[model samples]
Target: MATRDTHNLRSVLAVRGFRRLLGVRLSSQLADGLFQAALAGSVLFNPDRQTSAMAIAAGSALLVTPYSLIGPFVGVFLDRWSRRQLVVFTNLLRAALVLPAAALINGGGKGVAFVVVAFAIIGLNRFLLAGLSAAVPHVVEDRRLVTANSLSGTLGSICFSAGLGIAVLLINVLVSAGDSGYAVMALVAPIGYVASALLAWRSFRVDELGPDHVTAPKRAPMHSAIGDVVRGMGDGLAHLASKRGAAYTMAAKAGFRALFGVLTLAMLLLYRNYFVTDDDVHDSITGLAFVVVAGTLGVMVAALVTPPVTRRIGGWRWVAGLIAGIAIALPLTVSSFTQPLLVVAVFCVNIAAQGTKIVVDTSIQHECDDDYRGRVFAVNDTTYNLSYVLGLFAAALTLPADGHSPTAVFIVAAGFALIAGWYAVVAGRWARRVGDDIAQPDPVPTPVG
Candidate 1:
């Protein structure tokens, strides 16, 4: 029985449904994280750090194209299948896709194909991601969403960081002990996939959204194919255009992306006078922040707390203000480090700004319908890549040569960050025009059976 008495998150977490959801999340989150690390590590840990980072950035940037093309259709896929099943199968498929790369470690001519295979895996995996992201809220009661996001965020951070650190260990162990150690570790992909798939398959049972179960199935004639395609395209497009929530979310996302572009550059060695490759700077204490202790911890704090903060503030507007404050602080943060204590203060401000921004940004993105939200998210992802590239290129070219000492790079970028914050604030205001207004509920009612 649903408990009216379950008023708090603690109560909600204690319930069987959320516990089941958490189990399923735990099973899959680690693998999903490992997948990302493999991709980023392939690029980041290359013999040449900067060159590899730029190359990977460029190469992976292309993945966004398919996501844009396939996004609208993915939502349709979400509606048609069982959410639980999709979650499991996607992980399983990831395992399968990566296994070949792992198995043929020393095979002739295959070394070159590893990157290509990884790319393909990435593309196909989006289908799973699209479905799983759409299904999260469906699996939990509304009030417990903060807890869900918090737990998921923490899991994601640990999973990604650990995968990066451990993958190396696994690779080393395999190379020394087994001929196919490389290939063997590749099995991690599939192992995690299959395990998560099992969890998904067994943990939840739900209905697929087809007519046969509810009424009767009717076959469409082959002649109707063109009409069907046209109808699908139209529906997808209409769904996006009509969604005030999604639109506002994207607008806010765009601003965040823009500001994030500037802020990230600010954190670089070129922008920060403190050594660009400061081990202390990069490795924060937060196990969840991955490398940055403060950053990792800050992110976890935001993840666990942002939802309630949002609830208390009442809307995206307050969040926009916080982001704006961060943007304004970005350039100033560099100058704030005149002394040792100031350096610590500078870092804390950056962390707080980044953490709060991310928590708010992700929540808004996922707050809409499943189908078109995929397309919207794809667009958001695409924009994020482009923005990152643009900022990096600009930094490399235009940033001052004086190790973050001159205000030029920070100044220029900070201006943009402020603009982004203003843009987000505007979008928040307009979000009301759409439906993301904290003051208003979802504009369109979800479909009822």
Candidate 2:
């Protein structure tokens, strides 16, 4: 099975159009990481900037919540435009917007101007991502679509992480230069976006990443587009209601993402206000970077182990076991938190998070009809980000400035325990009842919208 998966992956990588599209994804995501890191540094880790848990939550809300709300519907318009052109336009817009965002950072402008530009850039980033996902089917063959998505998505994540690491390094190296230095770092990200735009423009025809000619239509009016989203979401939920295994596992995934967000907020506070003493923002950023590294390593481990492990124990069992492991391990590592323990805790949490995600995605693919799969994912993506934001706000209300609340940590563990218990009891039974009947379905072609 591993060998076959490998062959499929290689076959997808061999396609010229797919390779070009993958290049666009990598470079665009790399810029995303760079921009995100810069924003985090300017807002959270700046020595001169004072912040609290609530402030952090508000910042997160401002940056992420809109994406959660508006992202699902953006696909309505994606179907109307040529995806390749949309990609090119969005990358160019991001590049243009970064200048003001950088300037605002340079001048220390956290006022409305800065906020608007920042919001626009991030919103456009979301739009770009939706377009990219929609374009995948046009570049890859039908048979290898799953492998194509897996390879491209995995490599895109690595590129984003690389960009993040680079930005953090720049922040630390320019610690003395402060906001000015961070502004310079922000300037670096546009080069990536511009390069991505150029790749898209030069490598692919305007209609190459496309809504096929037969299905393509004029842009829907705003009201009509919104109505479509509402109807699609309802239909998606109905489909999930009938697919018990997928629905249960998806609920588990949302719960995990929310808890992960809570832990993330706690970690950020701990690093910024508790672990690093006196205004040493450099070491604070470094500590957080270490957590990222540990989590990334754990994600890598989960990716390597999950397929074979799930094949043996089954998806639900593997997912239930991973969450159960996290439930048992989190409080043990996080309650008496030290820097090393922080890394260990993040490592364990991501293993569960990514492992569950793999199973959940697979379950959705297997259980959902192809027509409904895209909308199910739209619902899934909406809940995923919203849950994370919800967790942030929930934690903000309860967590102290120093983020050293054993109570909060334990509560998170309890939350995980509950999710694991539900998965075990509900999803586990469903998996057992189905037995060996569960099988992979044909890849659902990526919807243009």
Candidate 3:
């Protein structure tokens, strides 16, 4: 009863900062969805199937790759400087970049410049996401972290799914009106970007404490740039290795992330085959049934249940079970294509996996110390993105454009999930051992008279 009450109180029904961030997340996602719609169907119009897909991906990667190069340096800066200023700077620049692309679309130019600018805007937006993720924890209290994150994740999923829906719907409307649909699609992102910028500029204070409290800035002596950078990176890596428990967390997260990447590739294939009909949604409303509704509910359960579950049931045992369930579900769904009983099983797996994933990720973040938090977190981000790219490329090669493509992706992703489940099992054991080492009782507190 007390536990239930505690969960209710920590319920995190509202926190102003989180609420603001949530709104921005939704708006940005709506725009992102529009962009996806803008790029999706036309890519295949070019000669080679693989080539066009790559072109579309490459355009987005143009943005992503640059951000990857800059993100670490940016993360370091985020820890070292005024976070608020950084937030405002990133938001304003992104908003400015986004507006012109939309204007170009409005003016009826789907030229190289329009695509190129859109790519750059998407890439830069990542740094803003990084900045926001890094800053959010600082603004919210420590205990409130899980609830805040859980809710945020739920909202993000909803917005992302809805954004895709909105993009499709808007494009349909534009076509009916005989307008260049790119303008309508492109406009969505800029509106969200501008809104996010305004929210940051007018509402939130650039939090100074996190930067102020972070580890001392490491300045290498003037020397050969390459050699110095390599050595500095080595030193930073050593600190990450020192945290035994943290190491387990990082390893598990990386494996899970890799699996996540594989799943993403599978999802694109799934939607292409199952949901789309001549670029129009068919009678099936699974996108609505699966993502917007079920996915959101899963997040809610994750947020509401994970804390107590982890504290009581412990970690690995719970996590391993979740992934294992996914492993079973994905293959069955792919092989049977959600045959009679299999479809229900797949949905159940999705709900369970999402819920536990929330707990596991949140706990990992909590374990991160302030000193190397940026580096560690950045590594997670980099690895996840790279994994996503590789998985996508591989799947695109194997998965066909037809409806059957989703099945192949699912089978491959199931393999990835099995690997993830294995990691969860091993990492859980490691976490327990680490716990034992740290469990040595604190030296008796000096007794007050």
Candidate 4:
């Protein structure tokens, strides 16, 4: 077994390419944070907007569903094109898309135009992120993947939260409590996106972050891209099917995400409506923001602890335990709808969710072939976004205006328990099939241009 000292984050960051990649990841996520916060504030919390659990679910669906629908196909391009170029082009495109979105918000437009543009921007974001995940192995050694993922994912999350905070502050300082504030906040995201694009352009040579030089088919006509995408997605799924461990890990992560989505939507409704009487929008937003802050702290702690814990208990077992932890923690912490208890629930769930994510990411990176990594991660992304949307819709149906539904919480807990059991069975079967391969250390492959 490798000692703790070997996987230290400082040693991983010492790699120049990884450091540059981290910069791109952090910058892009910060922009996403700002963009999402601005959109949420405009759509859900503006005084002119009618806020309800159903509306919140609709908003969440709008932001995520397009990516869920189109993200898998986009992964095809990730494998065919230069990922470094994808990172650069996608960010630049996103910056352009944000312009119309910001204008629509400023002009009080809320129909199809706004939704279409917003959807496109987020869809591009999915491609950019998948490329980054696929490129991570190229930038760092396999032995250091856990530490690298922990640092990048955890810190990128922090940057996102920081960006949201900055957007809120910008709104307060720049404009009134209506559409104009949201509009101005939307403008901030473009700056971050442009900066991220430049960083990506300057960070790596063309094809340095790669699809391993395998012969890829020539780009099809525009009319055939969709067909290509479907075939490509099928291929990706087949590849993952062969790697049972990665496939099951994604399934477990999807279940955890669905439960987390329920918790998120419920908490948003709780703060926006139930926690504060008299519809005090400001206080409700403040309460939700505090919960986010607490969750961020919990994510940091999870990053600190997960590497060691995964090392101690195999990554698969550790993920199973975290999933089980959610089932146990959810009912215990959130059955009562008080603010203090909800804060605790948020903190605990974030730890489990983030820890599970770290394990799943590292396991996929280790177990899956490099050539198929982007598509696999794209499928993983699709699973997460779609499952969360499903959970949101489910919560919208069951949750009352007050968001105090122990029944709903219990249902989610039950789902978590079922998922945990499924993960255990899958892990055991995979272990038996692979024998000691999971335990044996393999040298990182040489990078392909």
Candidate 5:
């Protein structure tokens, strides 16, 4: 099974366009990691800042919510526009936007100018990600999408972590310089964005990665067109409703992410206030970096584990079982609250998260029409971030400064168990009624040029 999976992966990688698209995703995600690390250092972990659970959670909400609200609306354009062009343009724009943001950090300016620039960069990131996901079907054969998504998403995640590690190292090296150090770290992110843009510009023709069918009104006035696009979100939702498997998988992912968010905040506070037990913010950064590495390694493990397991038992069952496993394991690993044990917990949770995401993404890509794919993915991204932010705030209300709350861990565990059971029951009934064998693979196509 492992040998066959490896062959399938190699086959997917051999496709020229898949390789290029994967490059675009990797470079873009790497920049995401770098920019996020710099933001975390400047906003949350700076020695000058007084950090707490509520403050951190609020900051996270502020950074995520505005873009999330507009994500679905943005999807309308993704369906109308050339995705390759969108990828290239958004990357260049992000690169341009980061400069002033970095300069603001350099001058220790955390005012409106910094916030506005930072929000613009993050908003463009959402568009780039949705465009990338929607473009996957254009690059790979239908039968190979599961493997392609696993490889692309997992590798992208690892590269993002790599960027984080790199930025963190730079910040630590220049810790004496304070805000200027973080500013310098942020400037490094644009290089990745430019590389991604250049690769996309060079690798494919203008129309290669596409919304093959454009359904927007041709001659409508600008305001009227804007209204139609907003209304188009309903069409996307209606289309999603018809694809029960994809809808169920997306719901499961949203539930899992909310719980993941709670745990994430707990982990951060633990490192900052509990594990380090000292004044130096650098210690907390180092500790948190280890946890992030553990999680990234676990995501890689899932890329290997999920394809074969889903092939054996089907994607939905595998997803439910993985979530169940996390429910049972989380309390035990987190109850002790020791750094080593928490690392193990993070590793296990990410395996479940990434494995579920791989299945969810594949199911959506396979089931939905290309016309609505962008909006569906936009909805997907919005739900993903919103659930996470809500979870963060919810946990913040219960968590203390040191992040020690056994009750919180147990409650999260129970929530995971409920999500697993709900998904299993709902999805099982739907599959039976629809007579769809989701486990069945599509026949592999001849290799692409």
Candidate 6:
């Protein structure tokens, strides 16, 4: 009964600024989905591209490493600048970048030029996302944050998947499976970003989505800006360290992401190489697409289930149990690598990962001071991306080319179990110290009129 009442997306969407914010989130993520799909189709699944586990791992690292490197510094600006302006500028920048990115892909450019341009686009995306997250709390009632997050995050993901599906369809229809099709998909991304930017600029007032304090830093010279970012990041880290719940939540989410990375690489290699015959590349791509769809369904289910489940179990225990559940289920399901078992495993893992993400997001919002929320979220992004890269690296070193390594799977499972146990213990002690404050409602921010 409680779950049914809490499941209403309409209630959250009814909030004034929240609807516009959701539009911005959905639009940006839709572009991200399309951009990523174009890259995947052109690079990973392209017939001309020779893919191996090592190559895939290298590509994954290149894509994510920039986020880890730039996230902290970007968080500084998210705190210091007007978030509304940042969103508008970043989206416009991404729109401009996509044009050249599409040209390069269309013109058969694939090595250094491709990586550098794509990296810049993705890095800018990270900044935009951090700003959006920090801005969300400003738009809604505090008591509804979990529901708002679940709706926004899950719906954003659905839009992303929808974007990917559309890209796939365009690829199939426009140019018949080659660089041209992928290029067409890339062209679609910029429109979403541009639209999102326009929405943000029109919907939000200057400094309305805030730094929590009225004072802005004096406009620094270009050289001083860099120094300020460095100092601000240091201060952000120190501030995060002071918050026990937020720190622990970040660590727990990072561990789950690392596990996710390992399984993602493993499954990529497995479907692309092992499950299908050498001449059946199309069939392999189809199989992987099915897995992606199943994973999307899992994400949707997690969105529906997480809010009420977290309320019943407490956020920390809920995350811990979800992780522990995955730790136990992974090895048992994936050891044989049957098609049905693999699908089930993918579904379950995605559910756990998405649920954990929602709880952590809300916990961070609740616990972290608004002044430092951007940095804390930035650090959270950095940790998850770095851990994922580490997982990919580990998989590259350990998994066979065919990706048929039960031992490697078991190792990841064991890691998850260990992290889950440690997080549970730590969260328990912290909860006692704070007197189970996770259950307490955050002080509601004044609703944006």
Q: Which stretches of candidate 2 lie over 4 Å from their true place?
A: 1-5, 78-82, 134-150, 174-177, 205-229, 232-245, 361-374, 429-449
Model 6 segments more than 4 A misplaced? 1-4, 7-10, 214-223, 441-449
Where model 4 places Cα greater than 4 Å from the true spot, the runs are 1-7, 214-227, 436-449
What local lDDT score does residue 95 receive in model 4, on the 0 to 100 scale? Answer: 93
TM-scores, each model vs. reference: 0.71, 0.86, 0.77, 0.93, 0.96, 0.94
**Which of 1 and 2 is ahead in TM-score?**
2
Q: Give per-residue CA lDDT, model 1, range 43-132, as digits (tens).
A: 333222333224433454554444545555554545545666666666767777776655544242134576566656676565655555
Candidate 6, 125: how far from true, in Å? 1.6
Candidate 1, lDDT over the whole model: 0.50
lDDT of 5: 0.88
Tens digits of per-residue lDDT, candidate 6, 161-229, equal 888777767765666456777888898899999999999999988788887763566877999878878
- In order, candidate lDDTs are 0.50, 0.78, 0.55, 0.82, 0.88, 0.83
Model 3 Cα lDDT, one tens digit per residue, 121-203: 66666666656566656656655555566566666666766776775566445442122455556556667667776776666
Residue lDDT tens for model 4, 334-421: 8977788889988888888888888778877888887778888888889989999988888888888878888998998999899999
For candidate 4, the lDDT comes to: 0.82
Backbone clashes, each candidate: 9, 0, 1, 0, 0, 0
lDDT of 6 at 384: 84
* Lowest lDDT 10-residue stretch of candidate 2: 434-443
Which structure among the candidates has the greatest lDDT? 5
Candidate 5 local lDDT, 399-444, one digit each (tens): 8888889999999999999999999998878878876634655467
Q: After superposition, how far is residue 306 of candidate 3 from its true place, in Å?
A: 3.0
